[model samples]
Target: MLEIVPIRSDSRARARVKVRPPAFLGEPEPDTSVGQEISKAGVGIILCAGALIGLGGFLFFIGGLLTSGGITGFVKGWLTAFTGI
Candidate 1:
């Protein structure tokens, strides 16, 4: 015959409150996790950098084409890209 022992209810809840791995389940509703916060910040930085680089490149290309030959240069560049010639 085996005897079963039950843990104290309050103690069990307290144990769950302690910070540990598998953050999705153990953390409280309002608490922020260190690892998760860093990951979110890193993603935000990468997205912002990509957006800035893409916009900057587009503006530089347009500026160069306009200064070189105005609207005619822009049209020429587009046609060359489309026709691969």
Candidate 2:
């Protein structure tokens, strides 16, 4: 035999009374030293810029033989046009 139970009418009766602690206690505080943050950011930017410049330079050297606009291109153009050699 199956018995059907009556549902509770009060919404407060179903509410939870126990509270759980947060995984993280509170908001993280920002770094107060502006100069240090700026210096670190600047160093990162400089390193990235230097790496990009070096990569471009290497690619220019490698592909210069096929084009007349790269570093080798300008040199070849100058020697052929100006020196007539």
Candidate 3:
């Protein structure tokens, strides 16, 4: 197989190396509008998960109030208000 090597101006065995500029000479470009959309979606997911967790906790609390021994009038009232039972 033929090997590709850099051409040298000198007749010497050493090869001349060409200098190149830095790969990144300046600051990177800013993110586009898609980045904003991703940010909004992330926030939306967090909010949705939080709301679901809060609702689940509320339901669990209500269940506890209804199921615990010696149910009080206040607990019954709350259960009736929430479940219409």
Top lDDT prediction, candidate number:
1
Task: State the displacement of the C-alpha of residue 7, model 1, in Å, after optimal TM-score superposition.
Answer: 25
The digit string of per-residue lDDT tens for model 2 on 1-85 reads: 9999988777464566876454454332353367776787899999999999999998876676557667667688868989888
Estimate, for each residue in 8-69, the C-alpha lDDT of model 1 and write its tens digit.
76774334566655537644455667888789889999999999999999999888787868
Residues forming the 10-long window of minimal summed lDDT in candidate 1: 12-21
- lDDT-wise, the better of 2 and 3 is 3
Candidate 3 deviant stretches above 4 angstroms: 1-32, 69-85
Q: Estimate the TM-score of every prediction.
A: 0.47, 0.41, 0.44
Error of 1 at 11 (Å): 23
The order of the candidates by lDDT, greatest first, is 1, 3, 2
lDDT of 2 at 17: 81
Candidate 2 overall Cα lDDT vs. reference? 0.74
Better of 1 and 2 by TM-score: 1
Per-residue lDDT of 38 in model 2: 76
Better of 1 and 2 by lDDT: 1
lDDT, residue 20, model 2: 47
Q: Which candidate achieves the best TM-score against the true structure?
A: 1
